[model samples]
Target: MNRLFDIFRNKYFLSTAAFAVWMLFFDKNDMLSQYEYRTEVHKLQQEKDFYEIETAKVKKDLNELNTNLNTAEKFAREKYFMKKDNEDVFVIIREDAKD
Candidate 1:
């Protein structure tokens, strides 16, 4: 008990404790701010990864469309509802689906 009291009474120990408290709570970049920054970085990293995957898939599709005429026609027919000049186009929309 006496030793603990002496330690607390020491100027160096008190100064160090005060500095730690200041840095942890009072500094411009405190613990909470650092944690928020880290979380924001993680969220942005995940978004970047998702976008990269989507970009790769789009590039692959573009390559396929550029290389294959049949695939391009199929894509246009299915995606844009395009039809031949002599054919009639009929669009069937489900009740639950949006325009």
Candidate 2:
């Protein structure tokens, strides 16, 4: 008991314990920062996955449009409202029955 008390009362041991507590709770590279960075990394990974899926869809569409003229023309006409000369274009709007 005396030896333990002597060690606990030592200045070096007290300083070391205080430093460890400060480092664990108040340091720059603490647990909170690690959790925050992990959350940010997970969010970025989700965004990357979404963008990759979108890129793959676009590439597939591009490949289809490159090989199929009818698909290309249909996409152009639907997306851009493009039409050939002497073509009669009609716009049909459907109102939802619930609305």
Candidate 3:
């Protein structure tokens, strides 16, 4: 017990402990700020991954539309309301939205 008290009272050990506590709890860039930075980095990484997957899907669809004439025609007709010269197109809209 006396040895432990002596160690605690030593100037070097006391100063080191005080410095560590100050840096961890009271410094400008402390533990809480570090945790927040890590959380933001993880969120941004997830967003990047999601966007990359969406971009790949879009690229695949573009490739299919470019290579397949039937697919291209179907996409154009559905997305842009296009039609052949002799065809009359009628659009039907639903009144209620589905969840």
Candidate 4:
């Protein structure tokens, strides 16, 4: 008990404990702020990873469209509903289909 009380009474120990408490709870960038920052970084990293995958898919599509005339035409017809001047475009929609 005496040793514990002496340890607590030491000025250096008290100052160090006070500093740790301040840094953990009262400083400009505290524990909560650090956690929030880390969470935000994680979320941004996920978003970046998702976008990179999407970008790769888009780039692959673009390359295919550039290299193959048939693929380009298919993409245009499917995405834009494009047709030749004399061709008829028929769109079939199922009643049970969902958007």
Maximum-lDDT candidate: 4
lDDT for each residue of candidate 4 in 1-99, tens digit (9 for 90 to 100)? 999999999999999999999999999999999999999999999999999999999999999999999999999999899999999999987787587
**Model 4 misplaced regions, further than 4 Å:** 86-99
Clashes of each: 0, 0, 0, 0
Candidate 2 global CA lDDT score: 0.93
- Roughly what TM-score does model 3 have, to 2 decimal places? 0.70
lDDT of 2 at 30: 80
Candidate 2 local lDDT, 1-99, one digit each (tens)? 999999999999999999998887899988788889999999999999999999999999999999999999999998788999999788788988994
What value does the lDDT take at residue 62 in candidate 2? 98
Best by TM-score: 4
Off-target runs (Cα >4 Å) in candidate 1 are: 85-99
Give the lowest summed-lDDT range of ten residues in model 1.
90-99
RMSD of 3: 3.4
> Candidate 4 at 73: error in angstroms?
1.1
lDDT of each: 0.96, 0.93, 0.96, 0.98
1-99: candidate 3 lDDT, tens digit per residue = 999999999999999999999999999989998999999999999999999999999999899998999999998898899999999989998899788
